[model samples]
Target: MTDPAKHAVLYRMVMPEHVCPWGLKARHLLRSKGFTVDDHWLETREANDAFKAEHGVKTTPQVFIDGVRVGGYEDLRRHLGLKAPDPQAKTYGPVLAVFAVTALMALAVSHAAFGSALTFRALEWFIGLSMMALAMLKLQNLETFSTMFLNYDLLAKRWIPYGKVYPFAELGAGALMVAGVLTWLSAPVALFIGGVGAISVFKAVYLDKRELKCACVGGSGNVPLGFLSLTENLMMIAMAVWMGVMALQHG
Candidate 1:
């Protein structure tokens, strides 16, 4: 095991189900700092409320750094004096080119799949909607993109740390491609990630696995998972890439 100071961090006073982003952020931040963090995200709602009431921190994300209390997002930002990712064109050059290529490739694939349909068929609609759902799930919070690892859902539901490599890289790369909100980064990351998700949906449908939760994000209601999910992921991947690229170029 690595030295604690070299690679050990701990998060205490956590609430499991009530929120996911705060602890998530702490973990990601530690990873950025080259530390391995142990997260404690379990607290009773009543207990959580009592603590919050006492501290005058009415929400989740009350953080403690090295056992010293750090404030919530605003406080953390103030403390760190963090600079947001440069939205300026100078910093995101490669990202712009990648997204442009991705957008074109996606269009080609989409046309091939649908044969220039002005009105999409039911299968097409389902696929489109599913993509939106998955994309939105992560997009709902910017914190998701900042994760330092991936979960190998087919193998283990636990997060596979980014350090393990490959599939994790794919997951992170794919997530950024699909889920990033920044214009330059979001599109390519979305394209790659959404494309992967599309493929997964199709493969699952091909294998006839229908009972599982689709795990698609927003606007997915009782939708049959399978072809619809695949189509949706693929389509959004393209759009996200375009938006990201556009955002970068004009900056």
Candidate 2:
């Protein structure tokens, strides 16, 4: 008798116009798990449909191990005791990455300029750099970001042009703040936009209880609107206030 554990069969779609990604993943996963895959391709839509009907399965990329049907890519993962990704789970990876990189950048700049990494300037740079990074994400596709921003931003909804201007304003303010220059200009711009954004995020997520995607990372991300979104705006607000006070004390 042959050992069935070492052998697996996979049926996946391979049409001329497109190929199923899950099918490729299933094959790779099976190979990585030390199983020899007997790959079978359903090259046509008709064949795919017929195979699905015959197997009584709605989706393709079906895997069979040792004559036992193990189902599709997700099912194969479960059978192999692997953790599959959950589509509904919210992730803060983008924001976390931005914060982490900006924090490092702040320390580097502080050490270079002030001969110290843990100075007051480092905190300001961290916030400023983070703001710039976030603005860059939105600026990647201004139209898309503006469209999504309108969904929950109060000022953007009231004045449509504000959505279009937001990325530029954020980028400009962040750049100026990081340079520690033009405090008179950057402080007010940061204050106004941050104040408005904080209120809008608060109303949308808390008061109205609406489930919305954050436009912070980009228009095309799945990051849910919640605490991080509010925190971003709040940081800008706090930075603006602190900068304004410093400018006043110096003047």
Candidate 3:
């Protein structure tokens, strides 16, 4: 009889958030072992039917080796003899762990360049950690570098959301960074946030001489207008660039 394992296949189904974190290891190992791995991926709900029919299963990350139904992601790892890393292990534990380290790096870069090392100022020091926020801040600050973008009338009229625009951009980047940590799109989110933050910061420095009022975010009077403000924005820009570089390295 022919060996069924000779023509084995590997299958992976990725959905909103149920993808196997270690699936890459199994696939790579199989390829390295001179196995004719018939690997297939189903990324949509519509593709589930065909996979379910073939595997007699209706769940994601279904694993089959030599046409024998093993199980989901875990079974696939087992079939391929891929050992699972400890959940509590610190090194190479999760993909998010890498991003988390990048986030820390961005914050560290910002702090090393500016701001006091106070705990209350920690958030401020780490503000540029996310790529999206950094880029946005840079772009927004490029012109006038402050609530200076908004006229006094608009500030008084409570149209501050559109007045400064940098904060809104920062807010969006921050949200993306926070969300990225919890989702598979962490790299993309970080890239975008870092880009925005960097843009705002770079702009602030580039347009250092422009005079602008500090309506603050939501009239909060947080981000001031001046060379210091420009310095602040650049700090964020550097952070974004760092994050983008990190993502590219990981990818």
Best by TM-score: 2
Residue 23, candidate 2: alpha-carbon lDDT: 96
lDDT (0 to 1) per candidate: 0.47, 0.94, 0.48
Report the candidate with higher lDDT, 2 versus 3: 2
How well does each candidate superpose onto the true structure, as a TM-score?
A: 0.31, 0.81, 0.29
Instruction: List model 2 lDDT by residue over 1-251, tens digit each.
Output: 33456999999999889899999999989988888889999999999999999999999999999899999999999999998888767788889999999999999999999999999999999999999999999999999999999999999999999998998999999999999999999999999999999999999999999999999987978788999999899999999999999999999
The full ranking of all candidates by lDDT, starting with the best, is 2, 3, 1
lDDT of 1 by residue, 93-167 (tens): 332333444455445555676775332232223333334333444344423322321221232224333213323
1-251 in candidate 3: lDDT tens per residue?
33345565667766686565545555665566556667787777678678778657766555455667667655656666777544433222222332365457656654665653343224433543433433344454544544444443223135445434545555555554433342234334434433543444345445444434333222322343444434334544554455456557776
Query: Where's the lowest-lDDT run of ten residues in candidate 2?
Result: 1-10
TM-score of 3: 0.29
TM-score order of candidates, top first: 2, 1, 3
Count steric clashes of candidate 3: 28
True-structure lDDT of candidate 3: 0.48
Top of the candidates by lDDT: 2
